[model samples]
Target: MPSSPLLPSRPSLLDDLAHAALARACSAFRQSGSESFALPPVLVDATLGNGHDAAFLLSCAPPEALLLGTDIQPRAVHAATERLAAARQERPDCRVQIFCRGHQELPQIWAELPPEERQRPLLAGVFNLGWLPGGDKSCLTRAESTLAALDFLLERLMPQGCLSVHCYTGNAGGPEEEQAVLRRAAALPPRRWRVAYCRDANREDSGGRAESLVLMERLPISRREMRVAGLCQA
Candidate 1:
């Protein structure tokens, strides 16, 4: 009998379990707002980049929910701004605020908006960490800065609103930053917040051999909260 070329020399049970757990976690959350809202809450794409996450979040929020996308790269800000502006045709009331600064500057940017818009409830924030596509590698999110941004998010996000961090391990500092953030996530007091992780089990995706999506929420004693916490490796 000819040996199969791809067969593993040993069992990979632990890897299989970890992968399945992560897959289940990503599927836990249902998409918000089936249609739209009259005055939606606020959203932040802390990494901005191409504004894909920001655009999607805006669409899912209430019709009037405003959005602010910030990135350290000027090109990213421009790209996100342009993308969001174009996406707004379908969501006119969805105001967009683009900032050319580090994600840590979110609080300052949020404060600078008009009183009425700034006062809107923040639904959830998104962070796609890594270099701006085709941009300088040095400008990607840092560990210290990311933690600081999460602190800001926790303070500003409305109850039950979440913060999603898409961590990339295949790039500079991405693995280290993900580790630092996860360590911080582990210590988050149960009374104040919950941590979640989603990873594909099969490593079948073309993106990479593995990837992880992290979502953090502030909620006390809820079914969702418990489920999220249970998914955390920390």
Candidate 2:
């Protein structure tokens, strides 16, 4: 995968893990077969900073996939849009949507999608939470907005689909946002969702605060649970 010029020369460890998770999710979704799942899997970059992650997703996603991205900063959006131009040209079959809006607005955006596009199974969603790298530090993602977006995505994530949240605890409001994310991850019912929280205990790279990654996968409901929920015949 090509690195975006807007990003630093060295990729962060959190980024490496998030990218790996996304790649595995995409690969797994492809191997799951269309007969058992929806065609053209849908993936989202919830925090599209410079289009680096979006580009990476485009490379790994199924040939006929929908890639949605959102960013709160116009400059970030512009940079990402520019960064993805080559990839989009290379992969004409992949549909890409880049929104210059906050992740919190995802519900409204999702509501506006065509019924067919809306019906496509969301296979994965990745969030790099904090502020845009090399952008305004004052404009940061808040816990309320992040949680709202997470709630919406979690409800729609397909079975075996995963959500990768990379939280940076270095900036203003970052700790609060990370704490909120941890709380939500902890609250998910284990029967329906598998969640993991990882952090470096010995390293404090970002202003003496360690970064964390929260990975959550949606588990398929058993037939008994489906019957209990009235989703299947008794």
Candidate 3:
């Protein structure tokens, strides 16, 4: 008998730089410490894009956790809703809510949350910055709105919660948005937030530019307070 050819090896999740960020973000959520809330923790996808990130996060979320996604375009919302609905059919226990709104509207959503909902611990927030994939390229995320939404997310993140942002450098306004986010993340009080940026050194776009993923994790209140006091005394 003739020898059978071996099947091609499956691609690693980290093979794609963008997917690597999603993997890291999910890992952070998995490794997070327990929260005191009665309800399952919440995860927010600030940009729904093609719904890939939102769906991936939903698939990994705790059974009762709520996955919230937002997009400025009606089409994006509809697409994400469809994708999530399909996901729910397989994972019937998952809960997902999507909104047709800009990322900056996150603060409004926070305000609208009921007392009980507001009390739920926020586990993770994800941002895929730039224009929505396969959509109008001109409708790029603005630095101002992205910064505002990021600030709101950091404020609500639970102790040990994580925020991950994947910024593409090739699109219009992409560099500005990336710089603004980086500056804000860097300015976050180091005692309260741990910030890390990862870049694929070997990869470059057509313009020889590179993308980056920024991850910020909130520290415990006691630890933050101790560092603050130490700084004051010093």
Q: Which one wins on TM-score?
A: 2
How well does each candidate superpose onto the true structure, as a TM-score? 0.71, 0.87, 0.79
Cα displacement (Å) at residue 91, model 1: 0.2
> How much does candidate 3 score in TM-score?
0.79
Residue 232 of model 1: what lDDT? 16
For residue 188, give model 2's deviation from the true position in Å.
1.3
Q: After superposition, how far is residue 54 of candidate 1 from its true place, in Å?
A: 1.3
Provide the overall lDDT of each model, using Cα atoms, as 2-decimal numbers: 0.66, 0.84, 0.74
Q: Which residue runs of candidate 3 sit more than 4 Å off their true CA positions?
A: 1-36, 202-209, 220-234
> Candidate 2 at 162: error in angstroms?
0.9
Q: Candidate 2 residues 27-115, lDDT tens each? A: 87677554445356789999999888899899888768899999989999999999999989888989999999999999999998988
Task: Using TM-score, rank the candidates from best to worst.
Answer: 2, 3, 1
- Which structure among the candidates has the greatest lDDT? 2
Distance (Å) between predicted and true CA of 96, model 1?
0.7
Q: Per-residue CA lDDT of candidate 1, range 166-232, in tens?
A: 7777666667788887777777777777777776576743443455677677663454643343321
* Cα distance off (Å), candidate 1, residue 18: 18
Count the clashes in each prediction.
Answer: 4, 0, 0
Ranking under lDDT, best-scoring first?
2, 3, 1
Instruction: Give the worst 10-residue stretch by lDDT in candidate 1.
Output: 21-30
